[model samples]
Target chain A: MLKHLTAAIALLATPLAAQDFSEGSQARSWNLYAEIPAKFEAKVVDLVCEFTGDCPADCGAGKRQMGLLRTADDVLILAMKNSQPAFTGAAVELQPYCNQVITVDGLMLDDPDLGARNVYLVQSIVPPGETDKIKANTWTKVWAKEHPEAKGKGPWFRRDPSIKEIIATEGYLGLGLEIDEAFIAENF
Target chain B: MRHFTLSLLAGLALSSPGLAAEGTRIQVSGEIIDTWCYYSGVMGGPDAVVGSAHHTCALWCSAGGIPVGLLAEDGTVYMVLKVGDDTQTAGGDTLLRMAAHTVEADGMLYERDGLRYIVVSDVVSDLDITNKNHEDYGNVPGFSIPDPNK
Candidate 1:
């Protein structure tokens, strides 16, 4: 009887042990510049829908916002971040997996501006029962074909006329607060 | 016994290095602006403008779940984070209501990667309640003149 009670007690303690392990592992993975490669099998969800339970048809397409409802803890949502300009990185790859359960491989980025929110910069996504298919960043190709004049011209923002106007009037120094000038000058 | 073990684990997690508070309580006075517009310089001009003119747009963007940031008088932009216990109420809720108005907020400030975040506890608007803009008075002919009889 004592042995059985010991076994039962150990079974009850298992979850707590697992939780502690996860917390420690996650804490160690919180470096900003370091890209911690991670794999997660989760449901692709729109943040608005996941939080409000009001799923939209296009899944907030123009916003390019998507998150992963981690299978291990459904309550925890890993918001995906775009690594490229014009929301063309993970946003483009995760577009096909909306509202579907899929496996995603990515680098976890700790974004200070987002407060406690951590971003998953997705590298590739695989549908259930399918082999891993590398993400080729097809959106970049499409963007290049559409804007042939933009080739080697610099980042999209540099080529943007509206941004050019702001730069011309404000100078790059005027983009932030006047106080930020010293910091910007030192950094950039 | 199970409950005790779980509680202990929770305590340890909360007291962990990254989760523990290395900051002190601070009072910051600033204008609440939507972070997207402030950082991206897209919709609004790059310089953080706080006035009645920008209030409507700031409220709209903040209400749409954009992160609200406080551009303090000291020129520090603080990303308002929800207080630990108050998960339901976003930090933007109060900021949205007081958009474009100067407010003094009491909060615990945490810093990481040259960015600052404040988990606000209290907010007090600096704008006078009785002060009315000319637009609020509407078009009135010769209303500027005081009554001579009084």
Candidate 2:
């Protein structure tokens, strides 16, 4: 009886200890530049659409894009260029996140033409500096305000990336805002 | 109403063309007989140069004389002077109508249909809102407003 009780106690205490460990570690600290209260964080996303024409069923020609901002810890700019496969009739999209950062794990189709290796897992860490810039820069703010559906409540919130499957993987395409290879090699 | 203001402005133009500001100014200058929309050639691009892209231009008349379009030295076509918004009322003297003119207007100078023409910048109705003009309005012909020193 004591052995069973001890096992149950260990199992229950494991999650609590893990939670305590996360709170004590530096990994738990994150800043997702939002207008929320100081104790709470908000989510900001940027959706970009490129006006690529039609393509084959397997290609990512006519598809929308979605990106999110994870908390402040990791500054990852994840771009899901194609929300739906080719022939979906959706427009090519480009989303830029200014004041928010996000972490996501899913399938990302890589394109060699642009020299970028799309990723299934991306984590963006938007700093406080970027948030201030977005607020002050009238051009960036105007674009964000015009497209409320991209940030507001829409089908985008429910469209989750299927992390269970890996469709295809390749090298980075060297697209828009990406990590510098030289900087990564020197630092990471 | 427009005639009264324009005549008053034209009288000012011939009297005080000398008191106009120096750097990139939008003023009406000329002697008593010839009135022209005056602007200076700014060097830098819109982003680099200050007050390089902003200016206000307008046509004026004392009586019923139609305004003429202002032609550049190369005859490349410059200001299309018109009374009010209608071009037919203009005196074919594209120089008399008022519009915002840019100096380095290479962006708008495109070879379309085998003809070369440069488009001026946006037209501003209220120059007083800007604070860049430093000349006293009492001496200058026409009403010249300064740019905002923000």
Candidate 3:
């Protein structure tokens, strides 16, 4: 799913700089993370591993069991034990990938010296159904429909063809509003 | 050029504000793991040549070749020298082609919603690990087996 940004819709230009973990320290180490209490299991399910990609057979050599847990704030902690991807220092570590949730025993990132390790410990199991706080398809489609001109040459923003096909084929109209048809015809 | 790539990512963030925050935006950059220039989706789809067999590619890469991308539980990163769905590189500082089972890299980790990912701008992997370990490992039930031999 994609949504285009229009010149008219002035979005907040916030360049969230890359987070710096050099100063801070982890409250715990990756090994210590195992002590956190949570259910751990290994299963091969066809999850959209990375949103819209094929699920390979081995789940990648680093593919370990996935962890899930309901947090105190109704937020779920979904953690995995895999060789950390290439975006962090953990990638250099030689740890067998194991996707499991670690129960945080009062682990806090604010504590000095813990660093990413603190994050590892604090992040327990993630619960199901919590990830989709913002539905990707609806948001992108609606945005594109509203600003049709923002298609193609815009940011990786556009309506998902699958969703549009469903809506068009099923004859399921959203809100019965035709405010955006002309907009699409004029721009897209 | 570096600034341009960074700017592109930033611009994408503004338009698709949420993706930049969460690990939703998938940025694959690396040696082409397995190019399916005529890749047909498992079930079915346009034959635009998609890439697949990530697990097999990873395993082969571990043996001794620069395979594809590093897929972590959160996100993934690849070492791409050029950009094109069908285009491939064999081996050169600029034009390169190689497969691998292992790589060493550093990057930043990002998380959004419940997904976690790492966005890697720098990566270094050995291109000598593409062995036949793939055959040693059988396919898991109900999942597509990676064509490691490829």
Candidate 4:
């Protein structure tokens, strides 16, 4: 009976030991699609600086790409998707904390393509003293409200003559359309 | 003899880094879309292409230095990048000008993490834009059609 109890205790203790030693094992177990509450404390670095030694003064002034360098794991997490429209969401919130060690709390997103690279969509961010707040899509919303005339009128080349001229001379291909080579050869 | 020849051909195709490194030249048909609006469903859903309806918004986004993407016919979105000699450059003014139009792009194809990318070398407008698969945003709220009578 004593031997049986010892065997059972050993089995229970083995899993506990493994759990404690395995780094990020619990964090990695979260479902990729689920909204996982995540907090990353790291230095904000511009992705462009990784290749070109040109680290911007203010993380590209929120006009260029930015990412988070998780010092704990030595992984660079690309924090923003695009720089156009002055950026939105986490990109905007993290702009002020550029090159500084800050703690950000948000829902971790598993980008299908960049999943292995630890890319996440930040929902909210917090600096040293502040509490967490939702990251708003401010730029896009403002643009949508301001440009009422822009509604439903798209493929701007058809409406604007100046745009057409730009496309013709500058060789700006409209959208990603597969052109018929035969037709091009015959027409122009 | 036939089996041996097939094996040799397979080996050459697999082992040739030069062929893979340079990438395969392909001409793909698709709609040029702004990545942000398309993925986040901000302007519309994922099917939203840069069309006459969404041209203004797309132009605004593209002009602001957004990375352009090609939504191909086969349902693959290629993150369009510039083809440079040594390194890939950001999509420049040319991409902004082409914001939302059905176009055919000729370029080198690359795949990473199940996502496709085309380093655009050349592009042409598909004159028959109506035939392409584009999500139509028909006269949504806050947009007015121009008066041809005026």
* Per-residue lDDT of model 1, residues B1-150, tens digit only: 999999999986455432243667899987676554444333334342234333434444443334466787766777665433332122124444554556778887866434566767777545511111212321111111122344
How many residue pairs clash in all the candidates, one count each?
A: 0, 54, 60, 16
TM-scores vs. true structure, each candidate = 0.45, 0.16, 0.21, 0.47
lDDT of each: 0.48, 0.23, 0.27, 0.49
Q: For every candidate, give the share of true A-B contacts it also has.
A: 0.00, 0.00, 0.00, 0.02
Q: Pick the candidate with the highest TM-score.
A: 4
After TM-score superposition, what is the CA distance of residue A72 in candidate 4 from its true location, in Å?
5.9
lDDT: the better of candidates 1 and 2:
1
Question: Per TM-score, what order, best first?
Answer: 4, 1, 3, 2
lDDT of 4 by residue, B30-50 (tens): 877766556544455554434
> Could you tell me how far off, in angstroms, the CA of residue B140 lies in candidate 2 after the best superposition?
68
> Clashing pairs in model 1?
none
Candidate 3 chain B weakest lDDT stretch, 10 residues: B35-44
DockQ of each: 0.03, 0.01, 0.02, 0.04
Q: Decide which is better by TM-score, 1 or 3.
A: 1
Query: Each candidate's iRMS in angstroms?
Result: 15.3, 30.4, 20.0, 9.0
User: Any idea how many clashes model 3 has?
Assistant: 60
lDDT of 4: 0.49
Question: RMSD for each model, in Å, please?
Answer: 16.9, 29.9, 23.1, 14.7
- Find the candidate with the highest lDDT and give its number: 4
Which regions of candidate 1 fall more than 4 Å away from where they truly are?
A1-34, A62-64, A82-89, A110-118, A136-152, A175-188, B1-150
Which is the better candidate, 1 or 4, if ranked by lDDT? 4
Residue A26 of model 1: what lDDT? 20
lDDT (10s digit) by residue, model 4, range A76-161: 66553422224232444466777777765544444454222244455445565665544424444443454455545544324434
Model 2 score (lDDT): 0.23
